[model samples]
Target: MRKPRWWAELALIAVVYAAYSGGRILVKGGEASAVEHGLAILRFEEGLGIDAEHPLNRLFTSVPALGIPADFAYASLHYLVTPAILVWLFRRRPAHYRAARAWLMTATLLGLVGFTLFPTCPPRLLDAAHGFSDTMAHFSAYGWWGGEASAPRGLGGMTNQYAAMPSLHVGWALWCGVMLWRYGRTPLAKALGVAYPLVTALVVMGTANHYLLDAVAGVAVMGAGPLLAPYVLRLVDRLRETAEASPVVSAGCETSAGERIPGQRSVRTTADDKQEWGLPCSSEAESLGKAR
Candidate 1:
């Protein structure tokens, strides 16, 4: 197979991000539904807690600025860490690009879906109904993306303003962590692999940008991406098969067992061919004009 290149994938990423941004900007801001949804979630979580005075929830609700000092650490996540890791790994580890992109895109799609379906406000706005006050009010640096001009206006904020459940911030960290752990060799990378999600969990919690459940959902998305990607591809493969089976189709060659087909040609049986494309040989196939 011809190896995939990074530039094409980067271009694709741009397109995906633009689409995501555009779709998100369409939701109504300051919707009452958002507040109600957030309250319901809070109540559900309260019910599920260890007890009425669930220590974690109590502490979490009581301490608004829990992770405030770590705001800069959290901010650096999107602005620096994730993109850098993805870019560097993209060039150096071409083999992982497709899987990584598929996972990332799946997570993105789910996140957008969450925004549409369950538009809950973050703790910043969850005070009245939840009987909570600003735990993150003092943290000026934390709300960098909260303001209007700071966010990219994609054809006018079609986005859900209060979509805080399933924190993509936490989801991305988990994604990066897992990918790095699976594919990387370096110790520092591996260390970051374990630490990224943990740190992100803290960041979101401390700043009250997300509830514990949002982080849970984020982690769930990252974990599900890889597992789900194959099924997604199978669906694509099925569509291609269906399209090809139509009457007007001139079918491509189907190689017999143990045969390696060239990109340009096909055969039913194995044979020694002339050229090897310098790729690691995988099966019995051939091309023209080179050493044995």
Candidate 2:
């Protein structure tokens, strides 16, 4: 089996990420529909208290400090936690890398759609509400949090700050949990498989980085991809089977490669590459029945 060239692999990642980032810039810059969604969600908060009276929010916000002011702990964790978790996911189950990448890309698209449609403000931004101070003002925050890039009302920034309806932190953590449960089943792995997301849910609520409905949106986005990715993959797969194959690119990764021949040029042969898609693994059959 020929191997997938590193350059080709890098090229694929670059193209995908570039599209992902560009999509974010274009969508949030408009804040088209996100305003309506944001306002509606904000209304839900009217009956409940997000301040000192809400013990659930307080416990989530306070646990990280162990006594110190937890806002920074909450914020710091919010900022730093995702990349590390994603890194672990990729390293532990590289087999799911493609699916993981697709999930993230889809969520970004969904976020932009939300931003454009429902441009709403977060609790921290609600001036009429009592006991709300822009926590970001006191703590160091991301250079670009949302719509602060253009006029206060304009949508010309890295993101639609109002796009908080889908708690991506929840979405990604749930994605991580499902992937571990499906592909990396071990005792500790299974426990964390559950815990990481529960903690992430806590992180979002405690920090007020997201509202409850945002978490719901995140789950919704993740669920949508399974239905959507299959149809997309069918198109890619039709191109994969012409009996000419590469060493590095797996026939299973997408559907455009040819049959396996013993030359290693287009594939990577990583441990994970071998486990799931090592299609082109052998030239034994033209096309075979997939396992159940």
Candidate 3:
């Protein structure tokens, strides 16, 4: 397969990211509804005896070293590591990059759909009685993020705080991990591939930015990506082929007999050119002339 152009790929990524960001901001559900959804999720987890957010949040907030780094990871690595892996794939694994990119984009769109459908308040945003702490808020002085959900200081208002149903942070990290593990031949790369997603899931929970179920939903979204990516890629390819195959009509073009034909170029043609242009051969032309 021919490698995609770098500039075109960059533009595509930028457009998709912009759409994703805008979708998040636009789909901020009402705070009351979001809180209710979050509580419902918490209750469901409790019923299953798998609610781990409280313990993780408590552990992280109580320890400075853990909280500080986990805060940093929650705020920064979601933006940095995913793209780094994308670039790595584009540069080193061209053959796999297209499918991987499609999968990532598909999963990201699905995450956005989840955000739109069920905007859940994160554990950090829950009441004090919930026993969860916002690690980013606690470590605000140490990093650029304000008390808000990983947004930079004073810029938190720009982000959708309630769009936290399926955590794309964990989903994207999973994507990056899979890419590294699948494509990176180095042992270190393989190790990072396994560790990155697991650590990110922990960090997000420890920071209270995502519930365990949110992380599970994120994984579910990524799982669906591979199954859907082939159809998405195939649709794109079909559209591209259709565009390329469409005839381009040159205005004022005419045949030798003064008959204007749509989509015919205005140029003299040789036998090979006639064949390429879908025009009649010399013998056919002569026969047509005699009949006329």
Candidate 4:
């Protein structure tokens, strides 16, 4: 494994994040369908006798002090913690960062596809008749959020409220936890790795930002991402190999002696180069040929 190109990697991450953000905003239609699906999901949970969001939200709101912190976690940590972990991994564990990043990106893309295909409204968006409380709305004053799920004041409309079926929040949190558990050296690190995702699951449910099934789907997505990573990485490797094999200069750029012309580009001479004009010897040309 070669050293990863930092600039290219950062640029790719930034571009992908922009695409995901823009994608959520662009796929903002079918509210009626989304509402119907959300209701159906709620009913399905009721049928299973595992519908916990209502009780959870009620418990959270019962303690105004706790609700404030939970709201802050739901609104902030979902975005902050994942990237912080990624940067840490990039700096400290470059060997593991590639696979971790690939898995996260894979799950995120799958979540986007879910949003496009099944835009189910979150519990917050459900009607009051359904016994759902907008916990964030109820506790918005204590935090920066303004009654909308994680969106700032007056900018709530920019976000797609219906993109809530498969919660990337839970998925990313779990991914972070998994990475930490597997790679972290200390016991406290491992404990926090397990704790963070569990806390995120509770936060998303308590804040009414996602369904129980949504969090389950998030885990399922993460599971699928690792399975798909091998194929995706192989494709990326093939593309990189193809690009490297292509010529970097014109066919006639170098003469039979394989020496650079004057004023084209400065060629640095190494210690062993004893040629009259500092030209590369036959052995050097052979090594360059093999490298190419």
Highest TM-score model number: 3
Worst-scoring 10-residue span by lDDT in model 2: 144-153
TM-score of the candidate numbered 1? 0.68
Q: Which order, best to worst by lDDT?
A: 3, 4, 1, 2
| Pairs in steric clash, model 3 | none
**Candidate 2: lDDT over CA atoms?**
0.53
Query: Residue 290's C-alpha lDDT in candidate 2?
Result: 31
lDDT of each: 0.63, 0.53, 0.87, 0.85
- Candidate 3: what lDDT? 0.87
The lDDT leader among the candidates is 3
lDDT of 1 by residue, 43-143 (tens): 77777871221233345445545534455555565557767777866788777776787788888888888787777876656655454433334444455
**How well does candidate 3 score on lDDT at residue 49?**
90
Which residue pairs clash within candidate 4?
Answer: none
Where is model 3 poorest over a 10-residue stretch in terms of lDDT?
Answer: 248-257
TM-score of candidate 2 relative to the true fold? 0.60
lDDT of 3 by residue, 40-118 (tens): 9999999999988888988999999999999888888888999888898899989889999999999999999999999
Q: Predicted candidate 3: what Cα RMSD to the true structure?
A: 3.3
Question: What is the TM-score of candidate 3?
Answer: 0.90
Candidate 3 error regions (>4 Å): 250-292
Weakest lDDT window of 10 consecutive positions for candidate 4: 247-256
Q: How do all the candidates rank in terms of TM-score, highest first? A: 3, 4, 1, 2
